[model samples]
Target: MSDSNTTDFTNPSTFILLGIPGLEAAHAWLSIPYSIVYAMAILGNFTILFIVKMEPSLHEPMYYFLCMLAATDLVLSTCILPKMLAIFWFRSREINFDACLIQMYFTHCFSAMETGILVAMALDRYVAICHPLRYSTILTNPVVAKIGLVVVLRGIILFFPYPFMARWRPYCSTNIIAHTYCEHMAVVKLACSDTRLSNYYGLFVILFVASVDLAFIAVTYTQILRTIFRLPTKDARLKTFGTCGSHLCVISCSYIPSLFSFLAHRFGQNVPLYFHILIATVYLLLPPMLNPIIYGVRTKQIWETLLRLFPPKGG
Candidate 1:
């Protein structure tokens, strides 16, 4: 949606998306599975959310962040999955310009915030494993809350400008975004202006944000590895690695699709539209799908708690 208030650039009256093809051709058939997955994604994340909140043992800083991450995934999945599924099922996936921008903002906001949270999780694991004495003091509830606040604030600053930039551009014709949703670059590409500045800035921001977070993560893990190596016992080493495996798994799942999408979209010319759709959806959906499983399966405390809460129905 163009800024109605802005005088310099007239907004594009409409934008188009290249939705799931062959299926958009047969939305009736596709929508069913799409809707089912959408429901599953939402239900899955919400279940983790409730479990974390109700269980006192899971109320520690790590789980608290995990819950927050789950919540972000809830937002992320709910935003994209539902709509995409509907398009697949019903063949009526129509989004207005303003609505698309709103979705775009939320999409980026939650995704960006999750990155920051993952970084925080890495740091938490580092302290818990390597610097046990400072774990409590370093990862206080208030501190975690502050970190969350920072995540949201930065997401807003980073995302808000893009829509306005889009709005400021003059619309030569109705714009269409291939692959579903008002993807940042897709929308930006349609802008009837020199997008070099915005593109460059976006690239820099992506690099800066991911690099900083990943750099810190690298540093934390490096120190953690060093500490683990110094331990004399095999059990100590295993325990140390075990504590971090979940975060590492989640981190890898989160970034791989994102990194691929980033490179593919920005640099991979001649890449098939379907390729983009698949990778983009993966980046958005996989994290939420795997997040709970990662924590639930990897961490014994969570698994044990869950198992105890609902033992085998019949002995």
Candidate 2:
């Protein structure tokens, strides 16, 4: 981490997060909203995890990825929200710089893994919907396990450069990060040395990696749709797309905000700074909150499993 991303606190160990400026002054009021969002995000993702784990009938590649997705979201939101809420609730923005960097690294890593996991889910859908006969052979437990390992490694490998890049520079003495969490680019920008190289690298990775992943998913689904069209019943078509509903929701939630945020950063001068920061943060939080609900409730087996897990008592 650079001094640019640090504050000259009395302790030297901790720095205040420059939370949304206006709201920081009203901690008691802001805490109410932040706490609510943090709670909802946690509970929602946990419920999805519960259903996926308990529902034996959902023990397929599709739901397995859904489980991974929900689990990732649960952790992702937890990692950032507690600190954010503390900042908002107590007017306590103090976070250790090492702690901030670690938080940023894991957050980036898990986020990358989530994208990869979603890609796997898309491939699973394509196989199940487009090639039913060979689905088992192609997406077996061993294969899925291998893919899981790849996703985790991919996450770590992809974002590992940021910390190293930060280390390579002579950091500046600025403290206030424009956003809530120490985002990689924001942190990289904090360095006193030339960040043009790092900036280009970050953009290349985001565009190349995120774009390639999205494009691959798009092509797989396009093929799946073509296959679904040949099915005898209209219900079969909806069923196939339905299997992808959760993934669709995730992709939309994740990618669109990124597109908009990037465009706003580049093009719009009048746009409020908090708009960018808040939207970016929300995009991260929403998928974890919504993934389980979108994927779990829509799944018949998971819905049934959830019911079984929480049955009516006085029937």
Candidate 3:
């Protein structure tokens, strides 16, 4: 066995994550809200998955995409929040180097998968609304499963290099990360070696994966809008738009904070560290917490199923 005392100059042994810098005194208080959000995310996503799985009527393409979304949300939040809560509740901020790398991998991989899933969901919407007659033929169960597999594989491929690249760079300086979770950019910035390659690749993944997904979503929605506009009656348009409301809300919830967080991290020279950190945390947690609520409120099927599951006492 290798000696624990022996040090490798290239790879860090451990990293100190300074959660919520300047608000160290408020970590305990912060944990309250953060813990609540984490609980909501877990419960909400689990409920979505359970409901979709248990209901035979919901075993369709749209709900299949939702199942993937719920799974992604569950994973994305789980990858980051537990450690964040540890930092807040127990002040356990020292993460082993290998563990940190693993956490970073999950964070990026799950996020990429989430983006891809959202794009897939948008495509599903486009097909159902624009080509209702061909929807079944286009997005069959096998096709949806294949799409899910591709999303997962694409995410893994994109993020696989991040940790390895960061690991090879020497972290000779004080290994302090100014965030609660292990993110690729945040961790790589601490390395002593030149990070041009890391930066380029990170930007590539962000642009290629997230930006591309967003672009596709926008295009799909545009086509959907054109189709909706051409509908014969106002009620048809309203009903169709209502069906899309939940997804639009979810898309906004996911992408807005994500874009803000990315911009702040990369280009917000005048922005405060706490702002970046807070946005990153929210960006990570908010979608998972809101997705189920949005779907439940806006989707008649899910709402009715939920009502049936929790019937009125008097009834």
Candidate 4:
């Protein structure tokens, strides 16, 4: 905890992660639910990917975006959960510094990718609902491919600096991070150097991405609602609105906890440290776990496909 002037300013060989600080005694019990959720996330997302890939009928723009989302969720959760489980169940808390940086990069990169995909999905729904006649021509296969590439490239470009920024800082203080994984800000905060630049850049990225993406979603949904209200029959309006329910649910699942965790980290001065850690953990776990379920339950096509793929024993 010494200042840089007094302490030798050398990065430690390894950083120790104290999983969910102050909850060490319950780490074993905590691992149970964490393990279950991780398993479910893996299983659910993989199923979505498999079904989408195998079903010729699903080779459309919307399902393609869902596949991207499932893949992003897989990477996002995998980047942290295994190490987290190690910390909780086996007391394996030491992480190589370089490896930690890699984990941080992938975690944030895919998170941003997920956000981008949600926006793309909003656009898809907007077109499907608001411009039903042109939906096919507007979201052609090549256009969908380009959108996917843009989403990937946007995340890679924006978050690519995070690890390098963290690496350049001099971590002369203690090498123990009070979280399960190498979160970008958590790692950067360990540095002894002035971190205002890193802090401001992080804030800027969050606000820029969130504000622009949310604004796009808001505009698209506004148009979609207007189009739906103009429909002639009540059933048509209900059916059209139903098409967006799953995306809306997934967006809520992904953004609400994420926004809460980010705000809690930055401004929740009176919030307990453990609560912040727990919310951060849930923010990562909940969306991946719920996205597939939301889609499968709400989308008749996916639900029917699942039923067809796994017929009842009596039938």
Candidate 5:
């Protein structure tokens, strides 16, 4: 471990990440599970992108949004997993200051992007279910492209201040980060100066993004459910609801852990440090690993495409 007393306290060249406080001895064992999750996330999301690209029938709005989701998952997981595994497996815990900022930006930016994509997906379902005759016209290829652009731009613009915020602060305190990655709060907390502005800004971003995006998603799904129930046949209703099953599962996976981590960091004073770190780390990884599996199993088209691409033998 680098000695804080000897190093320049104002601006250390590199910040030392502790991986997970209170679990240093178990780092090697913990790396195994995290590595597995990262591998699965990589494979699953890439497969989703590949299948959606190669299959002509999946070139519609829903699948296109799915591709966006997969890509976002890829960015979100990749932003942290490799560095985290390095910290755990090889004891490579030193991260350059600018690099840390970069990681923090991508981590939060893609998280916001994921939320926006989920909203777009909910809207897609709404149009498809409530107005089947006008679904195609409502979500045209151009509109979908525009929506994708907006999601990407929204994240980029919203998070562009994160790096600057962290960079402007003078880190005269210790250079050790208790978390695996350079999280926004963790980095800003190291600053010697007042961090109330940074802290409140972080809270504002979280509330603004989560509240607006989740509210839109809630309203969209409410309309969708109302439409589904209006159908006369039980079979029609069941099938219509079935299409949203995978999305609902994905939404739960994405938001629940995320909300818990966010709230716990702010309010869970009694929670152990390692527990908070573990939840935050898993929050970054678990959804990417689960999302592809959920869609593959629950969506008929994706499942059939997967089987066709890699069929079982001994027929």
Candidate 6:
């Protein structure tokens, strides 16, 4: 092929995100519903953060971990949605290389941090249920602060290599990203260079962080269940397990879709491209939308407080 027919691998600049292919005519209409969902996610998470911060009774370790999770959700949703909305609303899909890398960094970093926070929340529940006497001692304010700091640092350090890896690649291929946002694998696949190292690092990070955290959470819940089952009273068991319902719902919402999207992306060649992309978008968007709602509905304290703060009009 002639030089004019080939792309410049060393100096390509911009990437175009084709949002929800085969639906170009409906992009404007789709933006309305997506914008509503995005608004709910921001409002719900911010409300959770505000309630946890302003309510003195919610100064305990569990609420502290919840505040962290809420903040992570806020950042994650904000990172993915604004650009997506711009694409849907105004048909603006062009993203600069540097800008895409920044988005990639925050996307992975906050995701890992959210997983870390979930693990910390599980630990708090384990201590509360399995070792009630030691709960306060184990998860003190200083300890909670340390856990938050570690979660933030781990995310930043582990995912910092993502952008650098993408930057090192020579992208002579097409720059149109198939998804709505800049994901690690999506961006890596656009490169002209060998991406084995980058791909491996990405996989290792996911397995090391998310997989391990999920495993640990499982073990903690197992211990919690054993302890609850051993309780003398049925009401005690019901009450103890009730405390976990919200976390269970949040965990299920966060991990199940994400795991499915990852598996489908890597292995399910028979699946339609739009299905994979849609599931991936849902994996990112749904957790932020559902978590606060789960917590609000399942946790009696937060629900009661919310009602008290904003009473019904007829009441």
Best by TM-score: 5
> Which has the higher TM-score value, candidate number 3 or candidate number 5?
5
lDDT string, candidate 5, 87-134, tens digits:
988999999988999999999999999999999999999998999999
Per-residue CA lDDT of model 2 for 1-315, tens digit only, reads 635345433223444577776555665676676677767778877787676667677788887787787778777888788888777766577777778778888888888888899899889988888888999999999999898889888888888887677656655466566667878887776667789988887888777778878899989988988898888899987877787776788788877876787788778889887777777787788677667667666667777777778888884
| Pairs that collide, model 1 | 15-175, 16-175, 16-176, 16-177, 17-177, 18-178, 18-179, 31-88, 31-89
**Each prediction's RMSD to truth:** 4.0, 3.3, 3.1, 2.3, 1.5, 2.0
TM-score list, all predictions: 0.91, 0.90, 0.95, 0.96, 0.97, 0.95
Best by lDDT: 5
- Candidate 5, residue 300: CA error in Å? 0.4
Candidate 2 achieves a global lDDT of 0.77
Per-residue lDDT of model 4, residues 1-315, tens digit only: 754333555777788889998789999999999999989999999999999987899999999999999999999999999999999988999999999999999988898999999999999999888787999999999999999999999999999999999988888767889898999889998998999989999899989999999999999999999999999999999988999999999999989999999888879999988889899889888899999999999998888888899898998
- Higher-TM-score candidate among 1 and 6? 6
Worst window of 10 by summed lDDT in candidate 3: 2-11
Residue 84 C-alpha lDDT in model 1: 76
Candidate 4 global lDDT: 0.91
Off by over 4 Å in 3: 1-9
Model 2 residue runs over 4 Å out of place are 1-13, 26-28
Worst-scoring 10-residue span by lDDT in model 2: 4-13
Model 1 Cα lDDT, one tens digit per residue, 79-169:
8876776566554446777878888888987888899889888878888988899888988889989988897798788777777766676
Q: Could you tell me the C-alpha RMSD of candidate 3 in Å? A: 3.1
Give the per-residue lDDT of model 6 (tens digit) for 1-315. Answer: 645324566755778889888777887887887888789999999999888877889889999899899889999999989999999888899999899999999999999998899999999999999999998888999999999999999999999999999998887857788888899999999888889999899999988997789899999999999999999999999999999989999999989999998899789999988788779878888888899999999998899888888799998
